[model samples]
Each structure stands twice: as structure tokens, then as C-alpha cells.
Target: MSANARTVHPLGERLGKVLPPLMVLGVVVAVWWAVVVKTESAIFPTPWQVVTGAMELVEDGTLWEHIRASLFRVGAGFGLAVLVGIPLGLWMGWVGAAYRTFNPIFQMLRPISPIAWIPVAILWFGVGEVSPIFLIFISSVFPLIVQTTSGVHTIDRRYLRAAANFGVPRSVLFRQVVIPAVLPEIIVGMRIGIGVAWLVVVAAEMIALRSGLGYLIMDSRNAGNRYDLVIAAMIIIGTIGLMLDGITRLLEKLKTVRWRYVR
Candidate 1:
């Protein structure tokens, strides 16, 4: 293709990605507004009402506080999950005995809903920030451990065999090859973990804490049916969740990990 064509093509691709979503969002909002108007919703909020509600929160300074609290909790919990899970997963993946011992326990715990642990979290950590952080860690860490372990299992045997043939030290082989090879999978796990963590933190905040977006929704509801604020909180939660996912996706573009992300 010509240079101009190449330039135009990428611009087209970007627009292709962005425009459809924008169009769909517009249609959804239009329909939402129309429905609210027709139904004369005493409780349901129109798009503009949600916007106004958001602005009200912004004006009162509570919006940033709630957003900051939620982000901080997610960051802390997800950080802990990464630190604990990745190393544990790598060890379990490499050592047969470790895998045999730990796999059953994690598998048993994995299927339980994080929400179900709210009582236990509250009991263990009390109704404080630690409760939600602990829940987020619990919710996020499992997927990372599972994914990283699976990644190690699936690493090409030839890589290991070739490293062995070359007399590469066990430590060097693990550091240079195993870690790099497993990074893509680690990123995948992180993506899943972060999403779950965000969800868990919000839920924990709603039930146990006073300061996150989740609490904003619950609080808005109780304060004379402020459904607009409720919807605004919901939208903020969703938008931030998407942004977190996108940030995780950017890690896939790292040179060492990019090879595994085949189209």
C-alpha cells in the first residue's frame, strides 16, 4: 500500500474501533432518555439526570473521595495478590510435590463466590478497610495462581530440554527462560485478577465499608431514593473497571511477552 494509504488505514482502524462504540452508546442513551420520559420514572433516572447527579457529587467533593478509596483498595489488594500468587504459582508449577499438595486446596476454594466470604472477611478483619482489601486479595489471587501454574505446565518441553542440553544452570534457566516464558500467562492472570478484585472491593465497600463507589450507591439509595446518584456510581464503577482492564492489556505489548499474544 502507498504511504498515504498506510496512514489512512491505521486512522481508519482506530475510528473503526472507536466509532461503533460511540454510536452504540449514543443509541443506548437516547433510548434510555426516551424510556424514562415516557414512563415518567419516579425512581429511574435519565442520562442527563445521571450526569447532573455526577456533577452534584463532584461539586460536593465526595466523588473524588469515593473514587480514590475504591482505587486505593483495589491497588493494594491486587498488588498483594500479584506478589503472593505469582511466586507461589511458579513454585507450585516447578515442583511436583508442591503442586500435588496445594492444587487440591486452591481448587476447592476457587469455586466459592467471593461475596459468600463477606461474613468471614467481616469476622476476620472486622468492618474496616482491611476487610475489603482482604476480600479483594482473596478474590484476585486465585486466578493468578491458577493461570501462572498452568502457564508453567504448558511451556514447551523443548525449551527445557534445550536448556538442559546446554548445561545452563537451573537458576539461570529459570530466571531467563521460565520467568520470561510465563510472563504472558502472568499478564493474563493479572487481567482476570484485577477485574475480579475491582468487583470484590466494590461489593465489600457496599457491605462493610463507608467510603467507596459501592457505598455511594447504597448510600444514595437509602438517602431518599437518590437513584440518579446510584446510576452515576454504577457508571463510574463500570468506566473505571474498563480502564483497569485496558491498562492490564497494555502489558501484553511488552517485548518479552508479546510473542505469546498471537492473533
Candidate 2:
């Protein structure tokens, strides 16, 4: 084959991967711009207006401040949830009595929307970073626990039997077998938990804090009717959430856990 022909296939493959999404996004933006123009509504911003608004925030350093605050809250809360949830879930999964005792409360609380806890969070933490952090933690922890528990329950019985037959100590069995078996589920839960944490933090920040992307959206609209900035904040929030999920999804690439993610 000619060198040009060889190069064309890989280049075509790359374009095939990228072109469809770009076309869809272009269509959406075109539609959005057309709607704004046809309506002639001053309130709804054009895509360019939103871009300019984002630029303004970027120049003023407000965007970074809000992003930093939001990221810190998510990281802290989600990190804490992972630390507590995994061990608790493992114990509960291993012990039927613990599972029975706590499962009811988990189910009860899990169904309650994280936003519903805002007032209680405010009352308990008194309008500080703690309130939002607490809210994010609450939103994230349950999923981790539930997924981890399910991972443990679904583990192959033969693996455990073999471990026992080999005279593996309880600690070694858990360290070597149980943890490895459940790590995939735990990573999945982490991806879910981080998304929830990102979602809850925005809501919490809107209600409980003076800073963060949620507050930026609310404050921009309420203070100056800045719909462009409101949309910009939303875009930033969504982009960051997607990035966090992507980071956790990378865990699935690990050789030990790749089977869980492979189609």
C-alpha cells in the first residue's frame, strides 16, 4: 500500500470518532442561536453572549474562586465518604446482622433527596462550609455503601471456599480476595458518588454559601439578571462533573478491574 493510503485509514478512524459529536454540537448551537434570534427576547442570551459572560468571569478571577471553592468541597466530602463508606459497607456485607440493622435506615435516608437536607444542614452547620460539605457527604455515602455491599454479596462463593481451604487467615482473605473482588464495584460507586457530590454541592452552595458555582448562578441572576453568566456557571458545573466522573472511570482500565468494565 502507498504511504498516503496507510495514513488515510487511521486519520479516517480519528475523524469518524470525532466528527459526529462535533456535528451534533454544531446543530444544537445553531438551533439555540436561531431560537434566540427568532424570539428577539433580550432575556435569553445567544451563545456568543454566554461566551462573553464566561470571559468576563475569567478576567475578574471570580470564575477561578468559585471553581476552587466548589472543587475543594467536592473533594473533601467525597474523599471522606470513600474512607467511611467502604469499610462500613464491607463490614455490613460480611455480617448479616449489621446489614439487617442498618439497611432499613440506609434505605429510608437514601430516598430522601439531598436538597431536602439543606434546611437541616443549615440548621446543624450554621451557614458555613461545613453545611455544604456535610450535604455532599450525605448525598454520596449511601451509593458507595450500597454498591460495595452488593459487590461483596455477589462475590463467587468458590473464591471464598478456596481461600479458606488454603488456610488463608480472615485478614488475608479479606485483603487479598474480598477487596480485589469488590474494588471494581467500589470504583463504580466512587464514580456515582462523585457525581452526586458534585450535584449536591451546587445545590448546597446555592443555599448555604456565598461562593461556588451554584452561588455564582443564583447571584448573577438575582443581582443583575445576568442570564449569560447563569448559563456559564451551569456549563462549568456540568463540565467539572463530567471530568470527575471520567477520572473515576479510568479506574476501570486497571488490569485487575478491567473485566468489570469490558463489554
Model 1 scores worst on lDDT over the 10 consecutive residues at 1-10
**Which residue pairs of candidate 2 clash?**
none
Task: List per-prediction Cα lDDT, in the order shown.
Answer: 0.95, 0.92
Residue-level lDDT tens digits of model 2 in 1-263? 88876675878889999899899989999999999999998899999999999999999999999999999999899989999999999999888999999999998999899999999988888999999889989999999999999999999989899989989998998888898889998998998899999999999888778999999999998987999999989988888888898888888899888877788
TM-score of candidate 2 on Cα atoms, chains taken together: 0.94
Could you tell me how far off, in angstroms, the CA of residue 81 lies in candidate 2 after the best superposition?
0.5
Candidate number with greatest TM-score: 1
| lDDT tens digits, residue span 40-157, model 1 | 9788999999999999999999999999999999999999999999999999999989999999999999999999999998898898988898999999999999999999999999
Question: RMSD in Å for candidate 2, one decimal?
Answer: 2.6
- lDDT for predicted candidate 2 compared with the true structure: 0.92
Q: What lDDT, from 0 to 1, does candidate 1 have?
A: 0.95
